[model samples]
Target chain A: MTFVIMFLEFFKTGLFAIGGGLATLPFLYDMAAKYPWFNEAILSDMIAISESTPGPIGINMATYAGYHVGSQYFGIPGGIFGAILTTTALVLPSLIVILIIAKFLERFKTNQFVKDAFYGLRPAVTALIAYAGYQVVAESLFRFSTFFETMQIGDLFVWNAIILFIVLMVLSRVFKKIHPAAWIGIAAVVGILLKF
Target chain B: MRLLWDLFFTFFRIGGLTFGGGYAMLPMLQNELVEKRKWTTEEELLDYYAVGQCTPGIIAVNTATFVGQKIKGFWGAVFATAGVVFPSLVIISIIAGFIQNFSHLEWVQHAFAGIRVAVAVLVVNAVLKLWKSGIKDILGIIIFIVTFVVSAVFSLSPVFVVIAAILVGILAGQVKRRTKK
Candidate 1:
């Protein structure tokens, strides 16, 4: 049952979450809302781990989610099977869609309708990504629910988290050559020192 | 056999080195696939990206599928997709099996605390780059703002947003063409 649900949910995600990897966030968050086995914090970990490691972010995340969710129901073998199912299901849509497009690439690649659609789609993808970044912000440094619930100033923000955010933002703009993984390493060190 | 192996290894190497998302693999793909092997050209690669963006699934996988189909037909697509995915399956299984459960430890928790913040910044940087390239005219700005607001506040389904955007784009193009005459 867990395996079947995982396959279907990820298949939906694969079919709908267009505009690339980061765009998968809202769908993943939706799954968390519906399931007890997943949580926002772990989703954040998925983003971090999936980003740093090899391969596509969406595939890595789907596999991670599948393994975790399946493990709860059937342990190790379920974990492995879940990973395979989720991955295959997630990429299946792309396999079909791309093959169709590639079949017509010579004739339709530069079609006017296609160009117009992309003209609109590209900007929307930009906004979608911005929304994804906004989500990362809300999930990471700001807990608006807690801030409202406690009605406390201290709960308003994670100061250290924001500081790290700002510093990295500034450094990225200035340095322009610092490797992305190095930034993660720095954040991990800062987190340990501040006891975040 | 050799074709499959080459497709697998080529994409496997790309899968291994790329750090962020599908887009991050662009430069490396250009270097390896275009410059080194001449499997595809710069123009074709960009087209693949555009098509991949409009298609379902990760752009990386979609791009791979298109390239594989172009080069080696059905099996090429299979080998390429499998190659790219092969790395993540192994690495993530290891993490999910062990480290992910213990990720609740205080130090690990704190590490993610800061890691998320940094990652947020990286995602923002990616958006900025996309904005520079994607958004241009008035219609583009309107679409961007509306989608961002809807997504941030209401958390609307992204599928709905993308579908509507496609319609708007088609209509806007029609209007522009008529006005030009």
Candidate 2:
């Protein structure tokens, strides 16, 4: 039952997550809120790992989410199964839609409805992704749970996270040639070295 | 059989090597598909990419499917897609299985914390890029602002937000056509 729901959820993500892999972030955020499979902290980790890994970010995230959800319910074997199911579910819609488009490539490309719909969707998808980014930044840099407990101003921020975030953001702009995976690798080493 | 196998291996190589996302995969696709094997011309590949972008789901997967269907029909599309996603399924599953065991470690926790910050930064960078490309006119800006506030402040489902945007977009397009006449 859980696996079935997982498949449906991922299929929906695959169906609607237009634009690219990053576009899928909003859906993943929604899943984190709705399911016990993952949380914001884990979703952050998933994003890091997915971005650094091979293959597409959207598919990697689906597999990762599937594994986490399945493992919690059934164990390692379940995780592997979940990974396959979720990945397939995510890819299934693309396969169907692309095949259909391939047959009518010319007609579809010139269709005004497709163009206009995408025009509106592009901005909305960007906004959705931006919101997802905000949630991630908050999860990483703010001590929300701790703040709730302590109810103090000092307790509300993860100062190290904030500093690192700013530094990395600047470095990313300055060194535009570097791959994101490299920056992530640098951060991991810095984390260990600084005991962050 | 040979062409199907070639299609699968070609995409598998492309998928395993390329990092970041669909755009990052382009130079590689040009090299492998257009330049090396002559499976497609540069123009056709670009068209596939453009169509893939506006379509739902991952762009890379959509491109692979389009190319495969063009080459060897349905089975080609199947194999290519399967090959492309195979590496992710294997690599991520193994990592997922192992990472949970080590997640409780102090050093691992620290590393993840740092990675988390970097992830946020990367996501913000992506949003900026999207903004430049996606937000074009007044309608686009309005849609962006409304979608962001609705989802961010009110915490509405992104699905609803996306659905509403599509409807509004089509309606706006129709309205513009009528006014121009």
Candidate 3:
């Protein structure tokens, strides 16, 4: 029963989460609020892992979330099952839609309606991704969860995080050709070595 | 049989090599599918991306599916999609298992803290690239700003925002056509 619901939820995400991988962040945020499977903190981990790993971020996340949810209910085997279930659910909608579109590929590509809709969608999708980027920054760098209780402005910022973010941003620009996984590996080493 | 296996392996390589996000897979795809394998042309690949953008699904998965369909029909799409996601299943599952077991440790938490910052930088970079490519005109600027405010501040559902954008785009296109006439 839980598995069925999991499949359905991710299936909905796959069906409606248009644009790209980051575009699915909003829906995942909603899921975090509604379900006990994962939380905002885990979502950040998902982003980190998904970004640094192979394959598309969206599919990786779906598999990760599925494993988390499934493991909670069952054991390790259940987690693997959940991963397959959710991954399949996420990909099913895309396969069906793309297959249909492929059948009439030329017509769909040249359609004025499709073109016009995408014109507006492109900017909106950009905004959606930008907003998602802000969420990651705020969640990781701000002490929002404790702000109301303490109410101290100085205590609001995670300075270590801020410093690291600035450093990484500069390094990324300077080392433009470096793979993201390498940066992540470096950050992990720095974190452990410096006790960040 | 050989062609199907080839599709699977090619996409598997693509799925395994790229990092960061879906868009990051583009260069890898061009190298393997277009330049190396000669499976798709540059323009056709762009069209796949465009269609993949508007359609419902992850862009990378959709592109793989389209490329697969173009090559060997239904089974090709199936193998390609499966191959693309295979690495994520294996890699993430192993990491998730370890992370769950050791997540309570101080050092692990510290590592995640630093990793989170890295994730933020990558996301910000992705946003900048999207802005460069997607935002073109005054109307686009307006839509971008409005969508950001509502979704971020008000926490509106993204589904509603996407639907509204499609309607507005079509309406604006119609109005432009009439004015030109």
Candidate 4:
């Protein structure tokens, strides 16, 4: 049952996540809401792990989610099976789509509608990507209790996140040539050094 | 056999080291895959990137898979996917083991605070690059704005938004055809 559920969830992820890994966030959020297996906090952790690790963020998250849910519901075999199910299901749609697209690429290279549709789809993709970023901010920075608090204009702000955001942005701009890995590495070290 | 192993190891190293996801992997991929190994040309890498974006799956994995397939057929994709995933599986397993405690650490949270901002910037850079590459004309601009506003404001499902855009695009094409006739 867990295997089947994992397969179906990832199949949907593959079929509909048009823009790629980042695009899968919204779906994962929805999944969190729908399934009792994981919650938003775990999803956020998944995002962090997925971002820091290799492979597609979506695949890693799916694998993580499968492992968590399957292990909890069934056992070790269930977790492994769930991971396999999600990975195969997640890539299956792309495999099929790419094969079909590959076959017709030459014929459709100059097709105006195909070109235009893709062109139009680009912005939508951008928007989806932006929304993913925003969701991350909302989750990390804003809290429901803060919202409910006496509408204190000053209390509404999360100064720590905002400050860190500004500092990182400045560092990125100032050290434009430095690889992002360096920054992430530094941050991780800082995390450990500061005992965060 | 060595070549396949090299390919696998190279990608595994890439997958292990890269943080901030696919876009962050771009320069590293170019450096390792194109510059060092000469596995594929720059133009081919760009083409792979484009295809990776349009298709499903993570761009990094899609790219690794495509490159792997190009280099060694089915086994290439298999190896590349494994290479890309191996690091995360190991790291995440370790992290997962200690994550319950790790989350409560103040410095860890602070570091995440900084990392989160970096992630935002990376996403912004990605968005800007995509916008430049993608939005070319008036119709393209309209589609972008419409999609952005609709999704950002209303929080609609991207699948539905994409479907609608395709429908509108096809309709526009048909209208143009009729007018030309």
Candidate 5:
């Protein structure tokens, strides 16, 4: 059951997350809401981990989500199996669609309906990515549960982390084209140095 | 046999190097596929990016599939797809092992905190870049705002929001055509 559900959810995500991996963020948040297998925090962790690691972001996330969820129900083997199943299901749509398009992209490339659909979709995807970014920052910089429970500013925010965020933002503006991996490495080192 | 290996090796290296996401693979694709291997031209690469964007899966995988099929048909597509995702699967599996063991440690916890903040910044920059590429004019802006608010709202399902955006886009496109006439 875990395997089937994992396969199906990711298959749907693969189908509908049209723009790219970041575009998949909304669907993932919904999945966290819908399933008890994982929660919002883990989802953020997945995004961070997925962003840092190699391979495709969407595929890495689906694999991580599937493994974590499946392990709870079955075992480690079940988790690994679920990961394999999910990765396959997630890419199946692209394989089919790309094959079809490779054959006839010439005709469809200039299609009006396609153009309009994409035009509208591009902005929407941008918005979705923005929403995703907001979620990531919120998770990174604040302790929401603590804030809600205590209703105090000190409880609500982690000033040290917030400082790191602002400093990173400044560095980003200065070195606009440095590889993201380098930035991630520097942050990890600083986090260790500061003892977080 | 060698052709499949070539496809796999090329994409495997590509899959390993790209950090940000599918879009980050663009220059690497240009260098390897066109300048290095002659698998695709610059124009064809752009076409793949555009088509890949609107397609139903990860853009990088879709682009790989397109390039693979063009080179060696269905099997070529398989090899390329496998290659691109192969490194991620391997590396992430190892990370999963370490994370399970060390996630609760003091230093690991702190490092992740820093990494998360850095990732947040990266995502913000990505949004800004997307803005320059995709959002222009009033209609695009309207679509962006509506989609952002609706999807960001906890109560609203993102599925409906995406569907609404597509429908409105099609309508707006049709109206713009009529106005031009």
Candidate 6:
């Protein structure tokens, strides 16, 4: 039953989370609301870990959720199975779509309607990404202040994160030739050392 | 065996190092897979990205799966996905356990506070970049604003918003087609 559920949930995520992994958030939120196995807090952690880690955020979250839920429900085998099932289900949609698209690449390249459609899709994708970013910021920065009356408006700003952002932005520009891995490494060390 | 290891290690490194999620991983992915390894050419990677964007799931994972399957087979896909997920699974689990204990600790809270601001900036940067890349024309800009306002203000389900936008876009395209004719 758990396996079935894991497969189905991930399948749905794969089927509709177009525009990429961050777009998976809204669906994952809905899943949390429907299922007792996960919650928003866990989703928050998933975002953090997913962003910091690699592959895809959606796949990573699915794996995390599967393992967490599966371990709770059954045991190690359940966890492993859940992880496998979730990853498989998540990738399945893209695999199928890619195969189909691959067959039609030449045709698609110059099709005005298809081009226009993609042109439309581009902004929608950007909006989706923005929304995902907003959600993360809201949870991490603003949610804390709402809990207490004494919390200042300034408390919600997260200066360290802002500083890191400025630093990264500047670094990205200054070191255009540098690899992203170097930036990530620097951020990770900074995160640990500054403990932010 | 070496093939599988390469598939796994590549994705594992990708998963382990990147921050700011899927889109942020794009340049890195292009660099590693397309430029560095030359496993997939630039054109192939772009096509993979396009398809990956249109399909469900994370673009990074989808790309990994596609490349993995292309390079090897079923086992390649398996190892690649595993590699991509392994880092997050370990990291999140450890954080979860620690959070259980120090969730309320002041310094920890302060740290997250700082991280939150950084996250917002990262998100803004992502949005700006996407806006430049995607919004090619006035119509695209209008569509973006309308979608953002509708979705953000009303808290509409993104699925419905996407559907509505598609329908509207198709209608607009038809109108333009008739005008051109």
Q: In DockQ terms, which candidate is top? A: 1
Clash pairs detected, candidate 6: A53-B15, A54-B15, A55-B15, A161-B114, A161-B118
All DockQ scores:
0.50, 0.43, 0.49, 0.37, 0.45, 0.38
User: How does model 4 fare in lDDT?
Assistant: 0.67
Fnat scores for every prediction: 0.78, 0.77, 0.78, 0.44, 0.71, 0.47
Residue B59 shift from truth in candidate 1, angstroms: 5.3
Give the per-residue lDDT of model 3 (tens digit) for B1-181: 9999999998887788666566556656756787678998754665576567678998889989999999999999999998888888888888887755344567776776676677677778756756766778999999999999998778675667778988988998999999999
Candidate 3 residue-wise lDDT, A1-196, digit = tens: 8788889989999999887787788888998899887899988877766755667777877888889878887889989999999999999999999999898864675788878877888888777767777887997789886886889888789888898889889998898766655666677777888787
Clashing residue pairs found in predicted model 4: A195-B107, A196-B105, A196-B106, A196-B107, A196-B108
- For A1-196, candidate 5 gives per-residue lDDT tens digits of 7678878998899898887778788888998899876799877777767655656778887777766766676778767776777888899988998998887754676888867766776777677667767888898899999999998979988898899999999998898656565667788898989988
For model 2, what is the alpha-carbon lDDT of residue A3?
A: 90
When summed lDDT is taken over every stretch of 10 residues in candidate 2 chain B, the lowest stretch is B42-51
TM-score for chain A, candidates 1 onward in order: 0.59, 0.56, 0.58, 0.57, 0.58, 0.63
Q: What is the per-residue lDDT of model 2 for residues A1-196, given as tens digits with 9 covering 90 to 100? A: 8899999999999999886788888998999899887899987877766655667888988898888888887898888888999999999998999989888864675689877777778787777657767887898899889999999989999898899999999999898766565666777888887888
The per-residue C-alpha lDDT of model 6 at residue A193 equals: 70
Query: What is the Cα-based lDDT of residue A161 in candidate 6?
Result: 66
Candidate number of the best TM-score: 1
- Number of clashes recorded per candidate: 0, 0, 0, 5, 0, 5
Evaluation by DockQ, superior candidate among 2 and 6:
2
Tell me each candidate's TM-score.
0.69, 0.64, 0.68, 0.66, 0.67, 0.65
Task: State how far residue A164 of model 5 sits from its true place (Å).
Answer: 1.6
Which residue segments of model 3 deviate by more than 4 Å? A1-90, A102-106, B1-76, B92-100
Compared with the real two-chain complex, what DockQ does model 6 have? 0.38
Give the fraction of true interface contacts kept by model 3.
Answer: 0.78
Off by over 4 Å in 2: A1-90, A101-106, B1-80, B92-100
Q: Candidate 1 at A1: error in angstroms?
A: 15
Residues B6-125 of candidate 1: C-alpha lDDT, one tens digit per residue? 998888877765656765566557656876789987546655765665678887788778778888999999999888887888889888998754544677767767766776777677
lDDT of 1 by residue, A1-196 (tens): 7678878888999998887887788998998899776799888878767755667778888888878877777898988888888999899988988888888865775788978887888887777767767777888878798889999988989887888889899997897555555676788799888987
Residue A170: error of model 3 in Å? 1.7
